[model samples]
Target: MLILLNILSGVALLVWGTHIVRTGILRVFGAELRRVLGRSANSRLRAFGAGLCVTSLVQSSNATAVLASSFAAQGLLLLAPGLAIMLGADVGTALMARVLTFDLSWLSPILLLGGVVLFLTCKQNRAGQIGRAVIGLGLILLALHLIVEAAQPVMQGEGIKVLFGTLTGDSMLDTLVGAAFAMLSYSSLAAILLTATLAASGVISLKVAVCLVVGANLGSGFLAAIGTLGQNAAGRRLALGSLFFKLAGALLVLPFAPYIARGLSFLIANPRESVVTFHLLYNTLRCLASMPLIDAVARLCHRMLPDRADANPELRPLYLDPGALSTPTLALANAAREALRIGDIIRTMLDNVLELMRTNNAEQARATIRLDDDVDQLYTAVKIYLARISREQLDEADSRRWTDIITLTINLEHAGDIVERVVTNIQEKKILHRLQFSPAGLGELEDLHARVVANLQLGLSVFLNSDLKSAERLLAEKERFRDLERSYSYLHLDRLAGQSQRSLETSALHLDIISDLKRLNSLFCSTAYPVLDAAGALRDTRLRRRVLDATYGKDAA
Candidate 1:
């Protein structure tokens, strides 16, 4: 009974250790990973590297897989990258298990000692990454020890031993039981690790342990599948590949079980190691065999979940999955991507505003309204997501992003308000009153439209390329738009006053659009502000001061 209690306590600690390791690494490198995932489209190799790096840092393959799936589901990551990431993730997790198997209680101290010092001592990104690596490494060892201790006496229980014998006896039966155990266990990684420890202690035969290992792999795939269930075709395909690789790999190994068990036994003892080995070999072999033929899988999944299907890609935004919330850095990184989607939609609405103004095209005007409604829907969706994230405990960087997301949602909604106004107040008024702009008035509006277009592109381009040069250009162009708007406003006013017979409706529309244009310019500026902050320009007192003075000073003036 005393042993049982300690084992339970140790299990608790394993959870805590896993949490500490995953969150710490994400706090350090989530942003960089987001960029990598965001940029790669057709490239599977790059995706695989990202998967390896993320899982290594977080020390949890499931967490990395879920994050990748969520991004792919949302159209941010391509299917190929996701597949590669899943493959690399297998190798990454095995490497971690291998590292933990060695007698490294001594090195845990050294790593953690240096990690603590580096985390506290340095103000650089490299130091942060190093500290994270150390903590992640330390956690793996500590968790391994605790989990092993927890399961040690379990092997001693006669009833449990009998159950294990029955469950792990048949290869297929063992696979099913192992998978079920893994799914219900809360942490498949823990389940496998505990099993590995039993194997190490010689409590369970290698054959039984191998079945559990295969089961754990399949169980973990459920997480990736659930995430992609409501996603786009690419996301569904990525999820399919992750599941197929694990399940197919398990099926392949059942026939050659004896040799595989012997090979793993030579290396280490523990169900966890067995689990990791299966995971590694499964992913590596599957990827090598099928990576060149991935298109077939992609094509299969595509037929299963087609592209033109405008299915509502549901994302929990918050608690979307309890499995994910503990890793705040990655969660926050996901939130930022959602915010960018909101921004991208607003850019389209702005384009519509100009399109209606320029061509008086009825279809374009209707499209603008339709798109505006979509943005509003997306805004509400994202706002709810960010709000949920805000409720979770966050580190400093994640905290800042949460705040930015709140501000961004409100700002975007305000943008919708401006678009609605343009649609209702200026646009509807123009066509209703049948008021035509004088040729001179029309040209000035076109000039303002050009500036708006340039700034919108500048904002998106800067985000995509991470180009610092575009930041300056974006700011300059926004200023140019403001100047152009003011000039147009004055010219319209002068014409109305100078011409004794000027229509009141035309004058009113001109003033309203002028106000709308200025507000758009202000939003353009704020859109770039977040990008600058993300670029670390927000920390440079010199540049920060300049941006503040230039933006606020002009506003104050």
Candidate 2:
């Protein structure tokens, strides 16, 4: 019972350690990884190589698959290249398995000590993230050592020997057991290493170990498929391609497992070494052989899961990934990305309103109004998703980021409402009432609308990139926009005083439009506040106190 407990504990430690390492590496180098994946892989070989490099660094093929899936889901990469990346990721994992099996028992203590110190000292910086990976590596090594030591006693037991004897080189059954272990452990690497350890200890035969390794690969594919359950069709297609590749590779290799085991036995004396070598060679050959077939597999996957004709492209939440919720930083990043999408939606709405103001097209105005529903849906989705994230799990910076995202989304929702009202007002007052502004008043309103759009674009950029210069520029534009609104208001009143037929007919509507646009500009400019505040550039007073004091002095005079 104690021995069993130790073995289970070791397995748990290995899984947890791998999780730490994956998340740590992602938090540190996620943007770079996305950039690397985002680059146009002009050739299959380049895509494959990129995948191999990224998976090796992150130490998980599943993570690579998820990244690739995200890229594909967003239409950033073609399905063929995405599948190619997954193939390379498999080879990368196999390579890591071989590298990790070496005698590194002496390094575990040093890594743990150094990693803990660095992580504790700088918990949120790059060094701390590196320390996190180091600690995970140390834990993995320690777990392996524990597994080996625990296996020895278990191997010696008559009961274990009797249990193992049931295999009798049944490749299919052994594969199933191995896959189960992989899924249960959530780490095929652990499963393969454990299988090799058992084989080395003579608890399992070499043939069974070979089959188990193949099964572990298949299990990883299964895990990827399951992981993408909540993802989009494109993401699911990429996962399906990966899963099929693994299935094909395993099916192709299983028939020769007996012969391969026999061949490996003569070339290698140690069963563990033989198992590891076979895993390496099998993945290398299988993945390399399948490189040319990526396009074909992608096509097949596309056929299996064709694009939906009825899908509403605008209504879906592009980045609200449930899987990301496990990692608070990543989840926040996803939510922020979705918030940016909302900004884009608002940008479109603003553009549509500008067109309606000029064209007086009621149909287009109604269409723009309907788009506001998309904005509202997305805002609600982002809010709910962020709410699901545990505040306790977030650090100070991430907590601030969470607040920023919530604030940005709130502002965006308000902007969308204001835009809908603007569009609705245009449809009713301008199109229905057949009212037209005076030529000068119309030109002023259009100019103000153009500046409002420019500020919104800058504000969205500032919010997304957190660029201080852009934030400053956005604030400047905000001030200019306010001046323009005041000037336009006065221009409309002058036209009203002139008794111009058009201006008098549209006087109330023109004033309302100016006020509404001012409100919209305020919401768009709000994106800059958090950025400037973070940089200590924002003053406590949002009102321009000096300008206000001058205005009050003039009024007094």
Q: In lDDT terms, which candidate is top? A: 2
The digit string of per-residue lDDT tens for model 1 on 58-175 reads: 7777767766776676666667667778777766766665555667767767777887888777634446656766765676566667656666677778776775568655888877
Candidate 2 per-residue lDDT over residues 1-557, each given as its tens digit? 67777878888888888778888888777768767877845667888988988888888888888788877776778888888888888888888888778878888899899999999998867788889999999998888888888877886677767878887668999999889888887778888778887788777889999989999998889988998877778889999999998899998989988999999999999998999999999999999889888888988999998877546777888887777676677688789889989988898998897777777787888889899999999999999999999886566778778888888898889899998988888888889976777778789888888888888888878877989999888888888888888887887778778888998887878888899999888888877766766687745463544322332233312
Candidate 2 positional error at 490, Å: 2.2
Superposed by TM-score, candidate 2 places the C-alpha of residue 149 at a distance from the truth, in angstroms, of 1.3
Superposed by TM-score, candidate 2 places the C-alpha of residue 35 at a distance from the truth, in angstroms, of 2.0
Name the 10 consecutive residues with the lowest summed lDDT in model 2.
Answer: 548-557
Query: What lDDT does each candidate get?
Result: 0.66, 0.83
Clashing residue pairs in candidate 2 are: none
Return the lDDT, model 1, position 156.
Answer: 74
